[model samples]
Structure formats: C-alpha cells, structure tokens
Target: MENDRGTKRSRWRDDDEERQTAERRRQEKERKRKQKQERKEKKQQQLDQNKPDDNGTSEPKETSADVNGLDLDINGLLQFKAPEIRSCRGVNNYEMLNHIEEGSYGVVYRGKNIDTDEIVALKKLKADKNQYGFPITSLREINTLMALQHPNIVNMKEIVVGGSLDQIYIVMEFVEHDLKSLMTDMREPFLQSEIKTLLHQLLSATVLMHENHVIHRDLKSSNLLMNNRGQIKIADFGLARFFSEPSQAMTQLVVTLWYRAPELLLGAKYYSTEIDLWSVGCIFAELITNKPLFEGRSEIDQISKIFDLLGYPDEQNWPGFKSLPHGKTINKPKNYVKTQSLRTKFPMMTSAGIDLLSSLLQLDPKRRMSASEALKHPYFKEDPRLQPPEMFPTFPSKAGQERRRRASPSAPVARHGDHLNDNKNENDDDDDDGFIMAAPEDEKFGLFREQDKKGGGFQLRF
Candidate 1:
C-alpha cells in the first residue's frame, strides 16, 4: 500500500513539471510574435510619414530621431540613393538635316536635337540586311565607343531607335571635315610642323587604344575627322575589337586594301595591335607625299608593291616568314631588287623621321614600334616642332553642305562566316573588294591633277 502511494505521488509531480515547461515555451513564442508585429507597424509608420501627399510633396526625413530615437547623426553615414531610370529616346527627337555618307556598317546624317538645338551626327545602323537579331559589328562599335572616351575619339552621345527594331541609330558629335577630303581639296601637302601635330594626335589616340587593349583594325585618312578648331577625332570603329594576351585568330579580310598591313595580305591568322601601327605608318607616308605609298590593283599587286618598297622578307628581316599560310604562294619577280627604297622614295624626310618610319613599317610584327614608343621617338623631338591645333588653317565644310563623292574604297563588310572560315581566300568574294567607281575627270581637283589617270585620291569617312 505504501509503495503504491509513493509511485502515484511521483507521477503527479512529473506531470506538474511537464505542464510548467509547456507554459514557458508558449509565452516565449507569444512574446516574439508581439515584437515582430510592433517592428512591422513602426516601419509602416515611417514609410507613411515619408510618402508624398496629394500635392506631390513629401515630409523631410528625421535623421536625428531615427534608429530607435538615438541621438545619432545619419549625415555621416554613407547613404545610397536609387539611380534615376530613363527610357531611350526615339529617333524623332532629332531632325535629320542632310545625308552625310554611308559606310560598311551604317549611313551617317547630320542631325539637330529638337530640344537642345545641338548638332549631332546620326549613324543609322545597318540592321535590315542582317538575318540575325542584331549585327555584331554595330554592337561592337557601340560598346567600344561607349567605353573609349578620349578627346581624339569621336564622342557617342546616345543610341536612338526608329519605328521598327531594324531602325537603330548612333548619335555622335558633329565633326566638320575628314582628313581625306581635306587633303584632296588642299592645294599643297601639309607643312612639316602640321604633319608632326597631326601624327602626334594620332599616336596619342593610338596609345590610349592599345592601353585599353583595343585594336582599331582600320585606321586611315578618311576615318580621321577634324573640326573647325583643327581638333582631329578618330571615328568609325566598326572593325575595332578588344584583344588579349597569347593573341587571337581574327579574319585576315579586315582593313581597307590600300591601308592593309603586309601580314594581313600574307594570311597571318594571329595578329595584334601591330597591324594598326602598320596602317599608321602608311598614313604617315601619305601625309608627307600627299599620295598613297602603295596603290595596288589587287591583293597580289599589293604584296608586290610592299615588297618593291620594303624589299623581300628573309630570315634576317622576318623570321618564320615561310610558316605563314600564303607565304609559299608569293611569286618574286626575276628582276626584283633586294634593296629597301623608303629612303629613296622619301628623300626630303629627316634621319630621325626615316628611323621612326622604318621602325613602324618593320617586316616583322614583333619588331614594329608601339604607339607609346612612337610617341617618344626622336623624330617628334627634332626640328619642326608640332604645330598647335589652334594655329591650323580652317577649311570650308564640304560635309556640312552636301554628300561629296568618296574617292577611297569603302571598308570591307563583315560576312557571316568570316570569322569561322580560315581556309577561304578573301579575293574569292568580289563583293568584299569594296572598289569604288572612278570619279569624273571634270570633278578632279588639287591632288588629282597629276595622278588623275592613275586614280583619284584615297579618302574614306564614316
């Protein structure tokens, strides 16, 4: 009987302890729920206080009383405000003034901003011909221009669209004259000082491009624009692209035929910024002579012209020359002279200038001068200092009036399989030749007088 009473009392004590633990857990959960509700109410009250009234005005935020009524200064804290969101304006925002010129990627037009009354160059992207969603060349041009913001580079204001998805335009700052057209109209070649100034600007711009890991595949006289103040702006980045170390295999069909590098003609699959330097060298020679250094009719003729001027490449000059895809196909003339003719061609050039030019036009891509190195060349530091842009002579704006006939060949259009097909010859497709019809003899001016029969002066623009 005593053992039974003891067991029953122990059972009752255990039940009482279990009930006490359950009550404590319930109270704790209820307390947490009340705290959460209070926090939500406080947040709602703060948001309601800051909300705008019927008059579109909101109450000033109370920084001192914020954070549990602490006497803290919120001004010292880093506050992040949401960025303002905006929609891309339509092409109607700009009034088309006149058609400027058409390029491989787009058609250019002088436009005026309806609101600001500011003049801008509108480039209508060639999207209608593309079967794909959007043209990669247009995307690259837009992305490159947006990333590269230098004074020498043409400024991209904004991108505007038309009624359909196919109609897209890139808005840029209006530049008065292109170097090619200006040179074509000029009575005489540029002065030594003027050349130095122009080259300095070009090199400066090139340095910025290489530093940013960009290779402008095409850099020629027509692609360079100048304003009334004589400021030169590099334009037309349709062929430009970013590169990395170890190099990449890009299409050999890039760059205009006249300004193309020798390596490109010889089927060099892996090339870098050196190709651009080669174009710069050609531009340099053109600036001095007021004529193209090597004006060839075709790819073979172009290579022959390069060899005639620079001499045949050997192991001593260009190592691994035989390894190039098209190297074995090169046909050397029986009477080919083994001597370089740069010095003979440019007799008036200074020793320093000759050295700089030779370094830039080196047969080996490895030996070509870099933009930074070219900038520091003794040629620039020599006599005939660079002329200031302000001192440059202003010319009548032909681009501002009407569309003038382009003498130079257009840039090679990018094809669908261009990057994928390495074995295909660029010459196989006649459409990619970019040959322009010769202008009428009566329309010939300044530089065309002597070389009218040979061909008109080379000038390209965007």
Candidate 2:
C-alpha cells in the first residue's frame, strides 16, 4: 500500500514538471513576438522620416541625402564610396559637328545623340597620369551637377563612361555663349539697371545652390554662360560637392586667386559658403567698374590688391586674421592705408548697393554674408527689376523646364550669335566663373539673341 502511494506521488510530480515547462515556453514566445513587433514599428518610423519627399508636381524630387539641418552623423551616411561611374550609352554612331570649348580640363564638342535625336555637347576630359592631383575633377563635376537643376546652373544630359577609348564623355545642354562673351560684345557700357537685373539672377541662382548644400568654389565671369534666347545660367562645378554635414576645416585652396575671399587668401584652413559670397562681391565690383575688383598677380599680390581696395585688416577689425595659415608671415604694404570705400569705385551705385558690397567683401570670412541671408537684403528687396519669385527658373532653363522647346525644324538649327561668341571669348580661361549668359536687360532684349542681346550683369548682393 505504501509503495502504491509513492508511485502516485511520483506520477503527479512528473505531470506538474511537464506543465511548468510548457508554460515557460509559452511566456518566452509571447515576449519574443512583442519585441519583434516593436522593432518593426521603429524601423518603419525611421524610414518614413528620412526618405526624401517628392513634393513638387512640376519637377523631380531631390535624391541622395538632404543635410539642411546636418542632424545625421556623417560617418553613418558615407555609404557611397568611389564608384565605377561607367555608362553603357555608347557614342560611336554620334557624329561630332562643331568643336565647342577646350580647356585645361578637356575638349567639348557639340554632337547629336543621333539615337535620341537630341543635340548635346560632349565634354571629354582625359586625365594624364602625370596630373596626380584632381584626377577625378570630372567625377566631382558630375556629383555636383547631379543634384542641381536651377535655370542658372548647367545641366548634364547624360554621362558616358567606359566608352570611346576608355574615356568619359559628359553630354550636356548646348548653350550658345557665356556672359563674359556677351558682356564683351555688348559694345555699350553696362547700364545701372542692367546691373540690378544681373545681380538678381545671380543671387537667385546662388541661393538655390546653397539651399542644396553646394558651394560653386569657382564663381567668376567665365563660368556664366548664355543660350540663344539670352537667359542667364551658371555653369562649371568641377570643384563642387554636396555637403552631407557642416563644412569642416581644410587647408585646400579654392576659388580663383582674384575672387578668393580675404580669409582664403590669408590661407585660413577652414571655409564655408562665405567663400562663395566673397567671390560674388568681387564679381559685383567687376561688373560695375568693368574691371576686376581685386586684381592680385600672385598670392601676395592678390592679398595686396584686396587690402588696397578694401583696407588693411588688423586683428582688431578681423579677430581671426592672425591665426590663419597664410596670415602668419606676409608682406605688408609699405603704407597701411585702409580704404573701406565703395562709393569711390562705383559713384553711381545706390547706398543699398554699397552696403551689400561691403558686407560681402568683409575681410573676416566669418562676417561674410550667407547666400540665404544675402537674398533677403535691401538690394534684392529694393531691386526695381525683380518680378514674382515664381517667374525665376532654377537652372539652365530660364525658358522653364515645363516649357517645351519648339518642335519646328528651325528649332533644331543651331546658330552662334556674334555678341554671344564675343562674351564667351572674353573668358577663354576664366578661373572663377564659367560661361554663363547675362540676365535679361529688358523684355525685348531676348527677341533676337544676335542683334538685341540681354544687357544685365550679376550685381554683388552677397
């Protein structure tokens, strides 16, 4: 009887243990399932917040990452390494008709994408093995141009890589002439009204570029180009790049020595958008005076030229001037005469213009105006020529991207205007700005590109 009782107790214990094991497993599964659900919700939230929005119906959406706030960690975002940017779009059958422009970078030839029945400019930049630095200037240009599409900026039609003898060919919109050419051929002196119009166009362009987190390190007369219709477009972004994070410190030289800001000229290691604004200021002075604002021959000559025009900047005026990389040991002019006067150069310019110019040409880069801030200044606010913001197109298509090109056979025929060619010829080697057209001087100026070309220049509002 005792043996039977013990056997019953043992059976009961075994059943209890089995039941406990089953309960533990059920609890564990429930916990795991809840945790997975929470994780999935979190992932979806992140994706929804970070993905770029395609908001504009009239245009395409922005790609890559927009770092307007610089909130994301840069290291985590550096996903794209050097890529083999090869395109399969062959150009063998395409016939090269006219040689467009040749420079230190490469040769540009106007050609028809026979397959697409579209006219395109083919830029061939072959990097020599000896040219150790900036071998991928073309690559940098592509990366910069990819994100921008303002009427003031150049547009890349397509990229042809690993084609035609291992060379890279960039097919871009074919513009007739550049601003430098147009200005040279105008023959008449630039009118004050024309200056305001040009400045408005340039300010609008730079503002868009800054919004996109790009610096056109080079901004000068040569870089601006024009089309047959006389619309202004900014071009040449070989040194341009997207700023995924806040601009960091660097010792690299940028911008042309002439338009280079006093800080860059002083060899300050770090820089930001201010550098571009300074160049804009110099270009503004150039347009008004019909001469370069600071014509520095060498690095030192350039610095001297700036001081001669602006003034001798001391640590008291420019607190950070002394610590700059190039500021330590420099040749000071025999007599340090500070000239903070713009009226002397442009007596006809308004007080508003003088104020904007001084702000942009400040010796301290930190004090330099921003592209955004500059846009709201009194110059643009008081601009007598500005129309509605909606009228301003973003890029090479001052004609409007939505505005279709005419379909007539005459539309296909390309004619190079003398005034446009003259503008382009002036800057055969402009380092700062590229071949861009002038801003519309009058409504009727664009009627005939050759005879009555636009009459505006980018005024310095930055």
TM-scores for every candidate against the unseen true structure: 0.74, 0.64
- The models' CA-based lDDT, in order, is 0.83, 0.68
lDDT of 2: 0.68
Q: Which candidate is the best by TM-score?
A: 1
Error of 1 at 403 (Å): 12
Candidate 2: where are CA atoms >4 Å away? 1-87, 130-134, 161-165, 244-246, 330-335, 338-340, 381-384, 387-462
lDDT of 1 by residue, 239-323 (tens): 9999999897889999999889988999998999999999999999988877887899999999888888898888888988888
Query: Which regions of candidate 1 fall more than 4 Å away from where they truly are?
Result: 1-85, 331-335, 402-462
Residue 82 displacement (Å), model 2: 19
Candidate 1 has what TM-score?
0.74
Candidate 2's residue-wise lDDT over 151-252, tens digit each? 877788776654445477888887766666555544344444455667767888999888888888889877877665435678887777666455777545
